[model samples]
Target: MQLLFGIPTNKYSSLIPTTFPENVSQLMKVFFCLHYSYKYNYFSISCWQSLPYNRPTFCELYEQINKIIEIMIYIIWNQMKKVILHWDKEIRDCERVMLELTIAQNNQRLELEK
Candidate 1:
C-alpha cells in the first residue's frame, strides 16, 4: 500500500513514522498532497482516508508550497526510509512466526487424523 506522494503504507498504524509530522506547515504540505492524490486517482490508504478535509482550492496552493521546499521533503523522506526498513524487518519476522504456526497446526492435525 502507498500513501499520497509515494509514502509506502504499513499494515499497522503504529508502524507509520510520519503520522504526526513535527512541523505543522510540513504536515499541511503532506495533507495537501494527500488530498490532491485522493482526488486525482485511486487512494486506497484506509488510514489517510480518515483525515477530515474537503478539496476545493488546494491544488495550486500545494504546488506553490512544494516548490519552495523540496529539501524539507528530502529530509522527511530519509527519516521515513529508516522507519520503513525497520518495519519491513519486523513484518518479515511476524510472517515467519505465522508460517511456523501454520506448519505446526497442520502437523498436529495430521497426527490427530492418524
Candidate 2:
C-alpha cells in the first residue's frame, strides 16, 4: 500500500510512528489526504482489520488491486485521448496560419515583381 500511495507522515514527525496508536490511528488520518483515491482507502482499511480472518484473503486482494489498476488505466487512457485531440487541433490551426502567411508573402512578391 505504501508503495502504491506513500509513507504516512504527520505535522509533528517526518518518520513512521513507533507506538501502536500512532501506527493505526495516525496512519488512518494520513490516508485521508486528497492524494489517496477512494479505492485505495477502502483497500487499506479492509486490510487493517483487527482479526486476520476479517481481512481480505490474498486472492481477494489480488482481484481488488486488479480492478483498481483497470480503472486507473481507463481514466488515463481517456485523458491521453483528450490531450492528443487537443494537440492535433492546435497543430492544424498552426498549419492553417502558416499557409495563410505564405500566401500573403507570395502575393507581396508578385506585386513587387510587377
Candidate 3:
C-alpha cells in the first residue's frame, strides 16, 4: 500500500517500493515515499525534516535501532547463506554428472578398441 497527497493505494499504483521508513506505519509509508520519490525525488525530503534534531541518535537509541539492525543483518546473512548453499549443491551435482558421463565414454572407447 501507499499514500499520495494523503490518499492510499497499492504498489501497482506507480513505482517499485523502496524507501526509508520513518513513520509508525512501516510498509505503507515506505511504499508511499518510494513511489512518490521515483518521480519527484527532488522534492519532499524526509519525515524527520523540520523537526528538532534533539532526538536521540542511533548510538543513543542503541536499545532500539541497533537491535533492529542486528536482527535484520542476521536475517540477511542467513538468506544469503541459504542461496549460496543451494547453488553450491547444484554445482556439485553437475560435477558428478559430468564425471559419470566421462566414465561411460571411456568404457565405450575401451570396448570399441578391443
Candidate 4:
C-alpha cells in the first residue's frame, strides 16, 4: 500500500493504526485524507484482513495487481496520445507561420527587383 501511495510519516503515520480495525470506520479516516483510489484501498484492506484465509491467495493477488497495472497503462497511454496531439498541432501552426513569413519576404524581393 505504501508502494502505491507513499511511506506514511509524521501525521500520516497516525492514519494507519497499530492494528487493523474490525470495521472500516478507522480505515475511512485514512482514505478520506489520502484520497486514495478505491481499487488500491480495497486491495490493501483486503490484504490486511484479520484471517489469513479471508485474504487473497498469491494467485489472486497477482491477478489483481495485473488488472491495476493494465488500468494504469491505459491511462498513461491516453495521456501520451493527448500530449503528442498537442505537439503536432503546435508544429503545424509554426510551419504555417513560417510559410507566411517566407511568402512576405519573397514579395518584398520582387518589389525591390521591380
lDDT per model, in order?
0.55, 0.65, 0.52, 0.65
Over 27-52, each residue of candidate 3 has an lDDT whose tens digit, in order, gives 33433454423522322122223332
Off by over 4 Å in 3: 1-60
Off by over 4 Å in 4: 1-40
Worst 10 residues of 4 by lDDT: 3-12
Q: Which regions in candidate 1 have their CA more than 4 angstroms from the true location?
A: 1-68
Q: Clashing residue pairs in candidate 2, if any?
A: none
Pitting candidate 2 against candidate 3, the one with the higher TM-score is: 2
- List model 1 lDDT by residue over 15-73, tens digit each: 23454556854544454455444532222223334332422235644664464357568
Backbone clashes for every candidate come to 0, 0, 0, 0
| lDDT, candidate 4, 1-114, per-residue tens | 542333222122223555445575554454344334776666656664654566678998788767666866887999999999999999999999999999999999999999
The candidate, 1 or 3, that scores higher on TM-score is: 3
Q: For residues 5-104, could you state the per-residue lDDT of candidate 2 as single tens digits?
A: 3322211322333544556656545544425578667665666554457667999878876766686689799999999999999999999999999999
TM-score preference between candidates 1 and 2, better one? 2
Better of 1 and 4 by lDDT: 4
- Per-model TM-score versus the true fold: 0.40, 0.64, 0.49, 0.67
Lowest summed lDDT over 10 consecutive residues: which window, candidate 1? 39-48
